[model samples]
Target chain A: MKGLTLSQRVAAKTILVIIFLFKLRNRATRKKIAFGIARIIFALSPKTRKRSINNLRIAMPDQKSDDRIRYLAVTAYQYIVFGVLENFWFEDIEYTFEMDAATKALITSGGPLSIATMHLSCYEAVPFALQKLTGRVTTLSRVPKFAAGLHSVYAKNGVCCVDKSQAGAFLALAGKMGSNGVVCLHSDHFGSDTELDFFQLQTGAPAGPAMLSAYAKTPLLIAYAVLQKDNTYIIHIETVSEFPIGQSPKAFQFAMQAIYRQFESIILQYPEQWCWFYKRWR
Target chain B: MEYNQQLKNVLSEILNIDTSNFMHSTKLLGELSELDSMSIVLLLIEIEKRFSLEIDIADLEAKHFETFGNLASFIKNPLTV
Candidate 1:
C-alpha cells in the first residue's frame, strides 16, 4: 500500500469489478471463483509467493519438503485474495460467533473491550461480526488509498476504521475504549517497538494491544474469523489477560507474548489461511 | 531534575530499560535498541501521562527522539512547531 503505481491501482480497481460481479453468484460459486482468481494472482505475484514460503520456513522449521511449503504459500495467497474479494460482499457470508463463557461475559459485561487479532482468513469479518453483538466497534486498519471507496462502505457499517498512519491514532483508540466501545487491533504484523518470541523468532511486535488495554483498563481478548469450506465464518474468541491498572513493563511484555502465542497457535492450525507473504519477522 | 527524573522513570517503565545510567548524552531512537516506532508511541503515551502534554505524531521528527536531552526538552514543552 505504501508504494503503488498507477497501473497497479487500475489493476486493483479492475479486480474490484470482478469481485463485484462475483457477488451476483451463489456463496459457494462465488468462493470457488474467488479462489480461482486468487490462484492466478498467487501465480503471478512472485514476491508474495517467495515471502510466503520464507515465512513458512521461519515459522515452521520442522515443516520439511519444499513442495508442501510451496503449496501452503500459494494457498495462503489464495486466502489473502479471497479475503479481499470476500470483503466486497462480506454481508453474504454466513458467520457464527464462538467464545468461552468467561470471554462472553467479559464482552457482554457492558464495559470497554480491546480485541487483539491477526490477519487471518476473513480477518476483516471479526470486527464486522463483533459489531453485531457489541454495538459500536472501532478497528485500526490500513486500507490503501486506492480502495478508499470500498473501505468507505465498511465504514458505513458501525465498524469505524482508523487509519494507522494518522498521528495520535492511539488517542482515538483509547477514546473509543473509554467510551465503552470495542477497539479491535490486528497485531500479527511487525508494526511496533517491542520484541517478542513469535514462532521461535524474535520480532518487533506492536505494543498497542497491551498499551491500550492497560491504559483504558479494558478487558483484552484475542479473536479470529476462520473461513470454513461451507462458505461460513466462525469467529473464535479467547481471553488475553485483562490489563491490571498501572501495568508495568513486565506485565506489558507478558501480555504481548500471550497475544502472539495464541496467534502462533492459530497460524499453526491454519497456515494456509494466515497471510504469510509479509516480512513478519523483520 | 524533577522533569528529568519523571521522564526517565517513564522510559524505564514503558521500555523496561534501566534509565539510571541515562544522561543528557544518552542516545535514543536509532541508537537505543529498545527505541523503535512502537516504543516511540509508548514513550509518547507515557510522556503525556507524566508531563501532561499532547504529542502529535505528525509533528514528531527523528530529532525529537535523538537523545534523552531532546526528549526531556520535548516533554518540558511539546512544541512540535
Candidate 2:
C-alpha cells in the first residue's frame, strides 16, 4: 500500500512467505526443511551461537568442555528454530499434556489462572493445548513488527494473543485474569520489574504472573513443553502458588524467586530445549 | 504531602513523567508513555509503602489505575471500590 510503513510493508511480504511455506509443504516435510535451513542460519550466526554457549556456561558452570558447550548451543538453536516455525502451522501439530493432581484440579476446576511459562521447546504448545481443552487461554507476546500478523495465527488456534508492545498490554492481561481467564505469560526472561536469583545470578524478573495471580485472587502456575522424538510435544504444568500472594511487594519478590528456582531445574533438565541465547545475566 | 500528592509523586518518579500537571481525570495506565508492565511493578511496590496498604487484594484491578483520581481514591480507602 502507498501509505504503509516500512515494517508494515515487510510484514505483508513476510506473511505471504509464511502462507506459502504453510501451503506448499506437508507438516513433516516442513519441519525437516525448517530444521535444515535453521542449521545453516545458526552456523552463519556466530554471535547468536556464542551467546547461547556463554549463557549455558553461566547457567551450567560444571559443563567445562568447550566442545560440549557448542554442541548444546547448536541443538538449542535447532529446537528454537523449529519451535518458532511450528507457529506457522500450529494447528496441524500434535501434542500431549501432563499435569499433576493438584495442577489438574486447578486447571480443570476452571477459574481465573495466571500461568508463567518459559521459552523452552515448543513453548506455545502449552497454551495451544490449554486453549483446545479450556477455550480460555490468553497469551501476551512481543510480536516483532515484521511478524505482527502472527496475532491472527494465534487467534486461529483459539489463543487470545495480546501484543505486549501496545500500551495497556499489562492492563489487558490483568483484565483477562480478573475475568476468569487463563492468562499465560513467558516468565523466563530478564526484566526490570523485580529482582530475583536465576541460575545463582541476580537478575530482574517480570512480576506480572505473581502480581496478576494476587490481583485476580487466583493461583499462579508454571507450565512448559518439550518436543519428543516422534514429533509430539509433551506439555507439563505445575502450580507455583495456590493461595493469592498477600505480602504485596515482599511476597511478590519471593514468589518470583521460587518460580526461578523451578525454572532453573527445568532448564537444566532440558538443556538443549530451553532458550539460553538471551543476554540473561544483564 | 497528602496521599494523593504522594501517589502522584511516586507515579511520576517511577514512570519518569511530569505528573505535577496531571488532573484527577488524567489517565495513568494506557496514556502514559512510560507506564508499561515493568513500571507498574515499581509503582505498586511504591504505593504499598507510601500508602501503607497492600495491593494484593482481589478487588484491586487495572481499572483502578484508569485515572489518577481512581488510584488515589483506592489508596485512600480501597473499601470504596
Candidate 3:
C-alpha cells in the first residue's frame, strides 16, 4: 500500500470525526470504539510495539512474566490513544487536583517560576487546568506543523505555547520569566543538543529551562500531574530552589544540575507513566 | 595521586556498576552497554558537581569518553594548549 497523502490523512480524520459525532450520545460506546481502534494501531506498528516492550522490560525488570509486560505495553498504548483524544477535546474534560496550600502559593507567588514536567498521561491537561485555576500560563512546547488546528484550540483556551525550534523562543521565554510570568517546560524529552542521562541509553535533553531560569533570575518549580487509578489527577508541585542571580554560566550550570537531580527523582518514581518509548537515555 | 582511580569511582557511582572488572582502557560507549546517552549526561552532570567545572556540549567528542583514562585526563586538564 502506498503512503497516505496529507489530504487523504485529513479526509480519514474527518471521517473518524463524523463517526464520533454520530456516536456522541453513546459516550461509553465511543470510548470503547476509540480504545479498540487504538489497540489495532498499536498491534500494527512493530517498531512502537518493540520499543514499548523494551521500555517495560527495562523499567520493570522484576516483573519477569511476559504477560505482565504485555499488559503494561497495552496499557501504555491505550494511554497514548486516550490522551490524544482527551487533548483534542480538552475543553469538555473536568479534572480534580489534590493541591496543598504550598502548591497553590507557589503558583500565586507572581514570580517568574519554571516548571519541569515529563510526557506523561494527561500531561497537557495539567498546565491547562492549572492556568484555569490560577490564571494565564506560559509553557515552552514544540508545536507540530500538522496540529495547527489543535494548537490554536489550546491557544484559545489560554495556553501561551512557545515554539522550541525558533532561537528567539528562548529569549522570549526568558523575557516572560523576567516579567514574573510562569514558564512550564517538559524537561524529560530528548533533543539533538540535549545532554544524555539514565532515562534512556542515549538521550539529548534541551537545557533551555535551566538556561532560562539562570538568565532570568527566576525560581525553578518542579511540577508534574500524575494520573491516579481513581481517574483523578495529583499536581505535584515543589519549589526546588532559585538560580544564583547574576552568576557566571558555570554557576547556572551547577544550579541546573541540582534541578535535574530533582527531575530524575520524579521520573524514577513513576517510570511507566513517562514517555519511555522516547529515545531518552540514548 | 592518579586521576584514573577517581574517575573509576565516579563512573561506578553514576552507572551503578561494579568497577572491580573495570580497567583504564575500558571503552565507555561500545564495550560497556550501561554507558548510554542518559548515563553519559548523568556522568557529565556528576563530573561537573564533583569538579566544580562547566563543560559545553560542543566540547564533547567521542574520544573524550571513549576510555576511562581519556575522561579523567579531560577532567584533569580541560584546557587545550
For B30-71, candidate 3 gives per-residue lDDT tens digits of 567676544564576677767777654324555777777777
What does DockQ give for each predicted structure? 0.12, 0.30, 0.02
Question: Residue A136 CA error for candidate 2 (Å)?
Answer: 1.0
Q: Write the per-residue lDDT of candidate 1 for residues A167-215, one digit (tens) a residue.
A: 4456667667767888888888886546789999888888777777776
Distance from true position, residue A80, model 2, in Å? Answer: 0.8
Model 3: which docking level applies?
incorrect
- Model 2 agreement with the true structure over A137-161: per-residue lDDT tens digits: 9999987656656766798889998
For candidate 1 chain A, which ten residues in a row score worst on lDDT? A242-251
Per-residue lDDT over B1-81 for candidate 1, one digit per residue giving the tens place of the 0 to 100 score: 498888889999878989999898898766777775456656766677677765543355567677899888876774632
Model 3 residue runs over 4 Å out of place are A1-31, A192-196, A199-202, A242-272, B1-81
* lDDT (Cα, tens digit) per residue for candidate 2, span B1-81: 887788889987888878888888998777876877767756776777777776543354677788999888878775422
Q: CA lDDT, every prediction?
A: 0.78, 0.81, 0.64
**Weakest 10 consecutive residues of candidate 2 chain A by summed lDDT:** A143-152
Candidate 3 overall Cα lDDT vs. reference?
Answer: 0.64
TM-score of chain B of each: 0.87, 0.87, 0.82
Measured with C-alpha atoms, the lDDT of residue A105 in candidate 1 is: 92
Q: Using Cα atoms with residue i matched to residue i, what is each candidate's TM-score against the true structure?
A: 0.78, 0.85, 0.66
**Candidate 3: tens digits of C-alpha lDDT, residues A16-90:** 575557346443454566668878987898888788888767656677899867766776676656555566666
- Residue-level lDDT for A9 in candidate 2: 82
Of the candidates shown, which would achieve the greatest TM-score relative to the real structure? Answer: 2
